[model samples]
Target: MSSFRVKGGLKLKGEITPQGAKNEALQILCAVLLTEEKVTINKIPNIRDVNKLIELLADMGVKVEKVGPESYTFQADEVDLNYLDTQDFLKKASALRGSVMILGPLLARFGTGRLSKPGGDKIGRRRLDTHFVGFQKLGAKFEYDSKQEIYKIDGTNLKGTYMLLDEASVTGTANILMAAVMAEGQTTIYNAACEPYLQQLCDMLNRMGAKITGVGSNLLNIEGVEKLNGTEHTLLPDMIEIGSFIGLAAMTKSEITIKNVQVEKLGIIPETFRRMGIKLEIKGDDIYIPSQEHYEIETFIDGSILTIADAIWPGFTPDLLSIVLVTATQAKGTVLVHQKMFESRLFFVDKLIDMGAQIILCDPHRATVIGLDRKYPLRGIRMTSPDIRAGVSLLIAALSAEGTSVIDNIEQIDRGYQYIDQRLNALGADIVRID
Candidate 1:
């Protein structure tokens, strides 16, 4: 395993361009199975999870060729459906949560899919019951071995119908949407996750001739099509990484610019940071953050202390709550962070507390941060990453701390961010990777 050793107290400057969205890239890659023609995807992030998904695609007889630094051509015309049952396929599929998306296209195009339980950050018990229930409503039958965690899905012709997801699970929503596009009848999905990534998926599917409506809302209406054709699509820039960069610039008091951020697609992200009193300048597709001395936490309407929380769609994304919490540690005021989605996500505040952050862990899901206000910088300390978001949060914390800090379990960071150390170093961040 590798770790990041950082000499902190460095002001990161210069422009950094974010790679493609990892979530969107994974869903787009799986959509390749829906067509026989060659699909070229540009700006795909070269990350561990993406590489694992590509390997899974290759194992299933899909031809993937790297045409550029962050571009690939994928053709699934010669897929072997039986490859899903192999141990290698099972291992790779079970390693990431995005693997569950393969089930939809696989079952839709090939009539069946077999795989093991999917694994990801152990934030909470993310149930696939919503996914299976939605698929079953669309004429798919699912059988699973609880002991081995193997799942088998079989269906003849997927017939779309009115379905309501119990929870707006992101992957679950994507899986059902993929399946419904090629179904026999009209599919109406209520309480769907309409995040930017899902919106991109819907847009790409429509480009490939799948009829979908309500692109940015909780209710999605998809018309089942007989076939989908291949098309070249460019993935959206990583909004989560863009948010992370914004926080890093604020904490380190750096003047930095983020390039090619799809300003229109970043729903509620820039506004959420603005609530923290961080001003941003938009120059076309780029976001510029000038040097900042302190961030002020906004108060509620009734003049009460402000508490920022995360919700499903059109709300601040739950993935960014960790970065918000760490950024608050260096801000000028106090705020309570309520993470409703994941239970274990707030546990990383303990590491921030060890670095002299004034944090009160209200519970497993809430934390109150008292900002240092430039009166004191965080002290460097050794910490282990618990998951992907927390790992990157620690890296952000380390960048603003004094002296040296070591962050272990960096593979967790590798699962999401592509060439993170190199990219950050280009922005004048003092980070080194060590094994």
Candidate 2:
């Protein structure tokens, strides 16, 4: 197992450029299967999950070429469908959730798609029923082998229709949308996931000859085209990483500038942090955070304690709640961090509590953090990372702690962030990778 030896209490400085959006890459990379033309994608994060999906594509005989440091050109002109039935393919594809997205494009273009149950963080119950039902609504036949944990979708004579999703599942919506974009007739998707990644996918599809309207709204109208062409798409900066860096700066009392942030697309992320009394300046497209001695949690307008909760897009994401919880450990007041989407995500608080943070685990989905206000710095200790987000959260906590801390199972962290230690070290963070 690999671990990170992190020394806390050092103020980080300099500018950080967030890598490509991990969530967006999952959807867009799968879209490469919808077309046979060469699709150029720039700003692809060099991370484990993304690379796993890319590797899966290569295994299926998709021609992939590296054009730049963080960019690639993919041509799916020749795909070996037989490989999907291989045990090696099933084993590797089951390691990441993003692999589920392949079902849509493969079915859309080739009339068949098959894969086993995808694997991901064990944070909550993420069901694929939404994706299966959405595909079925488009005239695809679905069959699941429970014993083998495999899903087989046959897309023959698919015709577009209206679908009101049970929930606005990001991957489910993207998967169905990819299928709907190729089905005959008009498809209307209500309550669709309108995240920036979805919007970027829609934009890329439109550029490639798909008729999709409602770029940033829940209601979407897609007119299926016979075929899609190759198009170049650049991924946006990872909002989760950007939010993580902001919390890191505030927690460690660092002067740092996050460069090239798409300020307009950040949605509710910045305002949520501001609600916790962290001050940041937006200089054009970048976010600048100066050193701070202290930050206080704000109460509600009615004199009640402030509660930060995760919602769908245009709302605070659950991905950042851990960061907020850790940052609040150093703040001056208490606030509740509610993760409505997942149940087990809040379970990481015990580690923070062990490191001297006052947090109350209200339930499976909620945590109330009472700030220490830096009255006493956290005493770093050895711990293990449960998941990707929690690992980064612990890393942030370690960065702001008073002593040395060791975090095991750092592969969880590498699955998302690209070269996290090297990038943070460039900004003066003292982190060492160990085996």
lDDT of every model, 2 decimals: 0.91, 0.94
- Which prediction has the highest lDDT against the true structure? 2
C-alpha RMSD of each candidate structure in angstroms: 1.0, 0.6
Clashes of each: 0, 0
User: Model 1: how large is the Cα RMSD against the reference?
Assistant: 1.0
Where is the poorest 10-residue window by lDDT in model 2? 310-319
Best-matching candidate per TM-score: 2
List ranges where model 2 is wrong by over 4 Å: none
Candidate 2 collision pairs = none
